[model samples]
Target chain A: MLTYPKTELNKVKRGTKRAVYDVEQINHILDAGFIGFIGCNYNGKTITLPMAYGRIDNKVYLHGSLKNRMLLALIAAKEASMTVMHLDGLVLARSGLHHSVNYRSATLFASVRKVEDPEEKKTALKCVVDHMIPDRWETLRPMNTKELNATLVLEMEIQSASAKIRDEGVVDEKSDLELPIWAGIVPLKQVAKLPVRDALLPKQLKTPKHVVTYYKKNKT
Target chain B: MLTYPKTELNKVKRGTKRAVYDVEQINHILDAGFIGFIGCNYNGKTITLPMAYGRIDNKVYLHGSLKNRMLLALIAAKEASMTVMHLDGLVLARSGLHHSVNYRSATLFASVRKVEDPEEKKTALKCVVDHMIPDRWETLRPMNTKELNATLVLEMEIQSASAKIRDEGVVDEKSDLELPIWAGIVPLKQVAKLPVRDALLPKQLKTPKHVVTYYKKNKT
Candidate 1:
């Protein structure tokens, strides 16, 4: 299996046992979520913001307004990093220290570049919209030239990445196992509720196949 | 209502209409979730990592192994920032540019200081635990001296903060109202499934009240 080469940058030092560098595993974690926390240095202070992203191969795409500060900082720095995480469950343990959360998280270190070509930018935009809802982009009104010019599309070529997954039940001290405290897992998930049709939508316009399919697959 | 004083560092530049500075609202956003994406400068590169946090009054607490790189970096810098976001839904619109996510997100910039007082550290730790599941810490086995010594707790005093909330339905263009496209919102939420007792637990031991309560309140 192909794996990202570990460097001092991407190494998971504290939890060595939970760290994973396999490219496929990392990609799996990335594909499971569309929102990522992107870190950038603003005036030498590190700040993070959540943004929707799309991944194709090793490239992750992010788009924002032309004056978006975080994206502008990334462009100025010529590098970026983003982290995506899915909270799976809560691990309740007999001991306070052992109480943890079950989660799958991945971090990518990448070089950032603007997608200036019109065709590539269009593809990236489609990738982002479709990433949130599969096959929905084609149904939307295409971007006009003014809208295209106002958006800034960035492509991040991942260099090294790491993922850490903790999917097990609680690990309390052996001595504390017999304690009367209750310990277990509470599985967590993001589920969809009933869809709300827009007020402006025509009464005759039924929800499309893609919308119905997404809801059916995601609803609890 | 008291509100956080916004500085250039914590200003919401792009989505001015959605910006919120009220302390109560920002705390509500923070209290809705325990996990936060903390940003820190590592070797001159910015990286974000997910960490469980606790808040009390105006201070936020984070604890990790003494060797955690991100925590250590925050200590060395003596300042930190973290972002917490709760995704609410997918806003499907008739145009690609209008596609967005309904979310409540907050960002905090703070000065970081290590909690050295044993009593304060214990309180902070309890706050962190109880934040995950209300009233959970009192039932767990208390931390031993060794465990306390091995953990590093950092207290972040909030300096400036801002929140952005988008809880509305789709806002499509007036011209696209007659289009055949389907536009609406697929509401999303994080929910809990049934609790699974630890395999090691005695068969006679029942799930505790706190766990049951949390599940009942969060489950779909």
Candidate 2:
């Protein structure tokens, strides 16, 4: 069911091979992340560019200036690939040699197309804004024609996607078991520190109820 | 300059044209990452793969198992393209519309070649391990011939590269500065927690100084 070369990947590169993949994991990582690394060949040159993104209905939407050339390379090509990853936690094994990461990430494979119509541009913008903050688009003022004209959009239908992960505790080689060292997962996580408010606002400024709501989410 | 079209990436897209790249940032990002992602079209089919790697003086050394078709594909063709990235921080905007990231990442352009001799393999391993843990090679046991036979090491010298960054704090976007909402960076970080001990017989295990040392190193 997995297309990645498991045996070849595992047998040769022991460090990267330890990563695991499953569909449920793919959704969770994407849902939680706001950035993706977009890679494409530009004018016969290769590039991996970082960008903020949103996913819906099995497709991903990305935007930039209309003048950007990578869009042309992608629009004219048969395929392009993008990846997003989160460094979950550091794996601290009994032996320092065996230490690894507990990471969550996804790669997307797709055929690309450009979105030229202004109506679609507006929709795409709202999709992204809403993805970052639920119900945000509904409250904000809509974009003007000038604002819409300045943006560029590309659609990548996720043709095939997969997630690679290492969330379990550390695995020790048989020879290292008796060594008197610590071993296991020392869970690493991205935590929201106490909110720092913009200084210009009065002391009464507060976090939105919805925004403050994430406190109960997995602190890990 | 920036290669990607501006309209495609959604809410998490750049807040300004500044987030796009010129040629220099692309090369820097490629030069800095610890590893990268590789995907290929195989006889009308495609595969996405991830591997641990190290960059030395602009040359990328990719080590894995001899069984990997990726290594075979690259070495036979004498060229390949891969994407590498390093995530810095997450941007949490006040209006969700303006939220972004503070990131420093790179992806390199390179070609693959086999590292055939024992000495060369040892040198490449040194770079890989040291890339993750500086001053680490001197502390460990060097690989034996049996271990070398079980591994595959491919070298890919970089040809070109690029970088893009999102480093600004929450952009109040002028017009929204008056909104009475908390706005600031949550400061995302990847940290190593305290290590957990092995399940077996050690009654008095303690973490080496590096356990706390490494965690202190991640200032992110």
Candidate 3:
């Protein structure tokens, strides 16, 4: 399907004008960032924490220690929801009420399941690592049996998702626009600095091309 | 108190070495960003959304439309938890198991209350704006009664909070350090770009000092 069939749960209620339901668009928002806020119920209170994730088609992968509380709770519940957001700019407005931020935000409701097969687990871990920095996972030393066994990998099948994007300049009251107050957008972005070699690295070992490429791509 | 007393709810479980309970350090993490991931129960599922927030002492101010579902849900529940995270870098390790990211993340649990007093509501709104761009709130046109009434302001009194900070280079197994693989840290940061003036702005008005200062501080 080109778009996700929105249920009451995934519908955007407040700013419907900015909402998007297209599967491709939602995926684009998800691919823009590797970190997402995954919500879990803890001690009768819902808490969200940032987690690194990898997406392959409609599936997202998350990994943590086998005893991680949030992952265990999500596995027990058999369902999860994750949200990813990118703050594009500050929408400085002429009036206090109109001040907003230009951002792209997507939330996904999914069916969560633990990956048991060793082969599938390996692929999932690679996906998660490559999602953060492309092409770097293959360069790392392979995971041994003990390391793989200690980690828990979860696969979330995206059931339904929606995204909201606001990428424009200020939207202020017409009357207030004529005021002498300055108004505009200050664009914001996440960037990478030069690579800092590990202190114990052999002096002859040079930085990898993949690391340099990532720096060049994300550097401001 | 110098530190928040750890409870079953706010204690860090997995990364004890990186966990921070000191109140000053938690506040520092909170002040580093203006957005937070707020978790709420919706349709029997917990969901998280990124929201802009302002902090003053122990209270966090969040403002949205009166009909916003998340805000209303928070008011009804009278409890809330918010998390803020800053991704510092990608820690590229020689081993897959040791690969991690350098970051500062904080989670806060608080009792939620709706701000009904007009003066307090105004103060809350101001706090949210100033938190985004210092000194810009007073420069904007004042909020009218209609705008104030349409907005819902919430005050969350932080009862407990914890921060985890991992800001270091790669840590690989001693056995893998001698391997010929490349390992290091690729530092990452969120930065501000040059401000774009509103399209309809009169050419005479220059960019405000507050915006300029913000850009100077945040720009790479």
Please provide, for model 1 over B16-111, each residue's C-alpha lDDT reduced to its tens digit, 9 standing for 90 to 100.
999999999999999999999999888888989999999999999999998888888898899999999999999999999999999999999999
Interface RMSD, candidate 3? 0.7
User: The CA-based lDDT of model 1 is what?
Assistant: 0.93
C-alpha local distance difference test of each model? 0.93, 0.61, 0.93
Question: Individual DockQ of the candidates?
Answer: 0.90, 0.30, 0.89
- What value does the lDDT take at residue A134 in candidate 1? 93
Quote the positional error of residue B214 for candidate 3 in Å.
0.7
Model 3, docking class: high
Highest-scoring model, DockQ? 1
> A60-111 in candidate 2: lDDT tens per residue?
7887777766566677775667777777665555443455666777777777
The C-alpha stretches of model 2 lying farther than 4 A from their native spots are A1-23, A43-46, A91-99, A116-120, A133-141, A179-183, A199-204, A214-220, B1-33, B38-49, B77-84, B89-99, B135-141, B170-183
Docking class of 1: high
Q: Candidate 1, fnat value?
A: 0.91
Query: Which model is ahead, 1 or 2, in terms of TM-score?
Result: 1
What is candidate 1's CA lDDT for residue B85? 100
**Residue A64 alpha-carbon offset, candidate 1, angstroms:** 0.7
The native-contact fractions of the candidates, in order shown, are: 0.91, 0.35, 0.87
